[model samples]
Target chain A: MGEIKTVIVVERNYLMQAGLEAMLMEIPGLMMVKTFTGDEVSLAGHIRKQQADVLILNPLALKEDPIVFLRKLKQIGKMVVFGLMEKETPVNLQSHFSHVLNVSDSKFDLQNKIRSVLHQDTRPGNHNLLSKREVTILKQVVLGLTNQEIADRLFLSIHTVTTHRKNINRKLGIKTVSGLTVYALMNHLVRMEEMGGATK
Target chain B: MLINKNMKLADVIHHDYTLVPVINRFGIHLGFGNFTIQEVCKEHNISTGFFVIILNAFHDPHYFPKERLQSIRLNILIEYLQKAHTDFLEDKIPEIAFLIEKMPGECLDDRKTYLLIRNFFLEYSTELKNHITKEEERVYPYVLKLEEAFLKGETDADIKKQIQDYPISAYEAEHENVEEKLFDLKNIIIKYLPKPKSDKLCFQILREIFSLEKELNEHARIEDLIIVPKVEAMENALKLKGFGNG
Candidate 1:
């Protein structure tokens, strides 16, 4: 009902934690209630005690088991957990957190992603998610190889590879080869440079 | 003789010997006795200062009065570095140059072949230069300083300052750069070489290049497992001393 205000920072690095706290405190109506430097066990405890509106997490502190920690955080209730990811966030882990922010992103982009997660209606709509295998098939398709060529390369039957391509197209609403290529680049699935002869 | 739980002499000796080849394979030749005491202490997670004392005992035959296992450790490390990295580099560099020279005539177009060859030369040269520079300028100097401080019985503060200023990522970034270039080179060769119009010369060059890439990959692995960890431990010790806390 009211404006979302309280924030709790859970990060391992002392410098980063201090910086984030300072930034959050500067934002009007946003209160950084507590900051803790520890792994998931301590973080879970802090969340329960603090009952803060949002939890800013440094994913590295989850100690090589980010998914398990994410699941644990989800069980703690309605509090939103945003992860500070470096470069690329693992796709499988994307489902658990409310939003992921790349640490290297420009300050403005970061602020926008955070604001969208906190205030806007950018929730990913219902779409049948492509399996990792399907994504691989889609990548190959973007590479401009025919079904038989992909099947031979992957050591799969032509029928199976065709099925995967169909599924990928149906799920992602990518009908044309050009569309698949654009999707691959936009999602950081494959860099434009790596596409090489695929573009032509 | 009561051995401290933290001082498992046999385990230390085993780890020390095992890591010699690994260090050598990485092309790191910082000298023997330079690493044994520091390395063993690191495996056991002891302070760098204490490690220095152990190194001192090992270096002086009359000090700890034990057999000169530390010297043996250093000798093995030197031998390994010589055979694995140094000798391999001597053999591989010439072979790579020969392959690059021979590679051009094989491709369908002279321009494409020249482009590929030039890219390979530039990428490899850049990566190798960066790698050597970092080791020479930052990593090696810090190791030398740490060893010197240990020999001089200098305080932790002095040792810590040297460790703090070491370039830890320079070695890693160079490795990554080489990896990227190797990937591109491999793909280019695979796609363009061995075309139906290809002759025997092209095949030979491609084969040699592949082998050279494999050797470099193995070299990178040794750097990661052996040299990098030692450098990292020294850096951590330095940071703990309130140096480079920023």
Candidate 2:
């Protein structure tokens, strides 16, 4: 890898932030530049000043509108924006971000996603941002619901759920549905316990 | 003499009998009125997490369904408290045991132990503040709304629909904040435990810190499992009554 990338983790959860910090510390080429808890209001100025390479943002911090904050992060320039999408992330809001990571993803997949996004050789490609359908599918995956379960829950055909999963994996460069499940938990999508319901 | 569920903390404080139990348990004397749990915690050394549990018990809001509290039978609460105490002992006892091993050869200073104890309390207090703010401002409100809706006999669909509009994920996110602070405080204790230069004061401070940790851990559990779920139910009830939107 080139020079180690610095990451500023902006998460609302104290425990998750500490855990993420510990996990990130174990990674080879990633350094946690700083970490802040709570919403963008408490963090905007500090993040702007720090100018770290990546800002790991928990979207739940945006009490009013997350898109506005995402846009603001984008405008700051040179900082890669990765959002921890909640389970109920609105459809309209999904389109605005460059890359969306579900909070439910596993530790291994989360590290992989972070590494892939941070170390990608090319200048950030047109971020294959997740669409509304993709997010819903991802949520189902996080819940460990099979294609059949997802189809039933969302009132769609099994085929559609599979297609959504495929699209999601393709866009995110993740290989398996298991990878998606890990992504969902680490990113706080559906929570780990909820997955037991859909895992079968 | 029973206070209504809608009664404010100010209202409860006005009743001498109700106020006595609150003051006795919390060690904070509120002069003649119902005060919010936040106020009570601030007055006492007790954590707001502990106070939240007591508040929910007092005010059976929709999100904070009475059922969750009922589920936490005395035996279960005692078991949990025991486990929490055990965890504290496991974590701190070793350090103290080691300090005791070294105490005879090394001389311990009271100043050093006092400094360490002070730092421990400071760190604990900081974490407690952050944890309380998140619960009061986000998690408690959501739970209260949920409880309110459920109490009104709203269908799951109606509750789901209402929740979809307001969302509970944010409150969960706030839970993560509390977790991080707890971790930070733990690290601080690990880092700052008095270097016992062969002294009894170090042992004394260690014991106090260990006890404090035990109390705080139990407080956190009660808030997370009991108060949080209850508040969610109350919030649901409020939503059902169309009083939660504001």
TM-scores, all candidates, are 0.38, 0.30
Each prediction's fraction of true contacts recovered: 0.00, 0.00
lDDT of each: 0.56, 0.55
Model 2 lDDT tens row, B1-246: 344334555666655333343334555554635656566556565655544555444432212333545454333343434343343345444444444444334543444343333433344445545655555565444455455455565545655665767555445444433233233333333433345464354446455455544445445545544554444545555555654543
Candidate 1 off by > 4 Å: A1-200, B1-89, B104-112, B147-159, B166-176, B193-196, B238-246
> In candidate 1, what are the lDDT values of residues B95-163, reduced to their tens digit?
666666655555444444454455455556556656655555655555556544444545366556445
* A-chain TM-score, model 2: 0.55
Ten contiguous residues minimizing lDDT sum, candidate 1 chain A: A37-46
| Candidate 1 interface RMSD value | 13.8
Which digits, one per residue and each the tens of the lDDT, describe model 2 over residues A1-200?
44456788877577777788888898897888666554323245446655467888877765546766666666565678887776588866765767777778888988888888876733454435678788888886766667898888889999777777766754554544444544455345666567565642
- TM-score between candidate 2 and the true structure: 0.30
Tens-digit lDDT track of model 1 for A1-200? 23335788777777787777766665655788666554322346446545566888876766547777777777765577888777666766665666777778876787776676666532354445778898888888888889999999999999899778766754554445654554565455777678788664
TM-score of chain A of each: 0.53, 0.55
Each candidate structure's count of clashing pairs: 1, 78
Residue B88, model 1: Cα distance from true site in angstroms: 5.9
After the best TM-score superposition of candidate 1, give how far the Cα of residue A92 lies from its true spot, in angstroms.
Answer: 14
| Candidate 2 chain A, run of 10 with poorest lDDT | A37-46
